[model samples]
Target: MAKPQPTDAQTDAEPENTEAAESEARDPAQALADIEAAFDAERAEMRDRLMRALAELENTRKRAEKDRREAAIYGGSKLARDLLPVFDNLNRALNAADDQTRAAAKGLVEGVELTHRELLAVLGRHGVERVSPKPGDQFDPHLHEAMFEAPVPQYAAGQIIQVMTDGFRLHDQLLRPAQVGVSSTPSG
Candidate 1:
């Protein structure tokens, strides 16, 4: 068979196609470098995700440990609160006893005093402490409940003139507020 003569368009396109084929043919080292770059990028992305997951896990563990410690520290708060009324009654009984009555029942009074002291010691050991604000001390609204206001010559306004009931605290937290009377008017 005889070869056909090339058209002008076909001749023109041939060189461009050859150039494209030559460009597509890459160096082996360059090809390997390209592959390594892609693999490195993928590895770096996976490592970042793994690091984030580990950080989140550590944070969760720390949070859980804090919660457990708080639970252990404040676990007996409710029981301690419930026992306050009993302590108050004991104090009231001691206050109600007349001098003659106390003398007559000295042994009984002494027993009650000892019991009160022991209970207080146990409570103190567990971080529970008494909040007894003395008369003429400055009244704190956070720790005291003002049952009534009265004018008194001895105390300035906003001063505690009387404490009706002693308060109690568990650590820095107020278990009960002190019942108190505040001086309403300033002393002359």
Candidate 2:
């Protein structure tokens, strides 16, 4: 028996049928390897993305914690700054009482002194410290505010000649710089 030849339509359809034929013609092991490699590449990319996301989350958490700590420490800064003048007035009142005033009003002077000391203790407990710069100490710009310059014969240039008002600090932060006079005279 003789077999009939394929028609023109069937011949055109042969190319379209090659997709199945090509897969069957290729080595099965090679095809499986290609699929496995594609899956491995996708898995690696996903893992990399996941790791980056986790690192970003960790960094955000650390930043939030640091911000919280800073807020806790510095939240009362405005209130502390406002109270500095009250502290200054107390010191001035104590200084105004001389020996005669103390003799005449010993009880009053003692009460004022006690009040001043208590205020200082309260401030110290809250981390507020006075930056007291004595006369003849080296002038430090970081802790002292230069209110005036004087050419005192006994002091060298840049030395503190007089302290006007003491400064206050809240922990490591300076709330106010100590007001002072710096000597302009050169050391002979």
Residue-level lDDT of model 1, residues 32-147, one tens digit each, is 88899999999999999999999999999999999998878887789889988888988988898899989999999988888888878888888888999999899999999999
Model 1 bad stretches (over 4 Å): 2-34
Deviation (Å) of 140 in candidate 1? 1.6
| Clashes per candidate, residues 3 or more apart or on different chains | 0, 0
Q: Which residue runs does candidate 2 get wrong by more than 4 Å? A: 1-9, 99-109
1-188: candidate 2 lDDT, tens digit per residue: 89989999998998878866787686778888999999999999999999999999999999999999887887667887898888899889889999999999999989989988888898888888889999999999999999999789888899999989999998899999999999997645
Per-candidate TM-scores read 0.76, 0.83
Query: What's the CA error at residue 81 for candidate 2, in Å?
Result: 1.6
User: Native-vs-model 1 lDDT?
Assistant: 0.90
Instruction: Give the range where candidate 2 is weakest over 10 consecutive residues by summed lDDT.
Output: 19-28
Count residue pairs with overlapping backbones in model 1.
0
Steric clash pairs (candidate 1): none
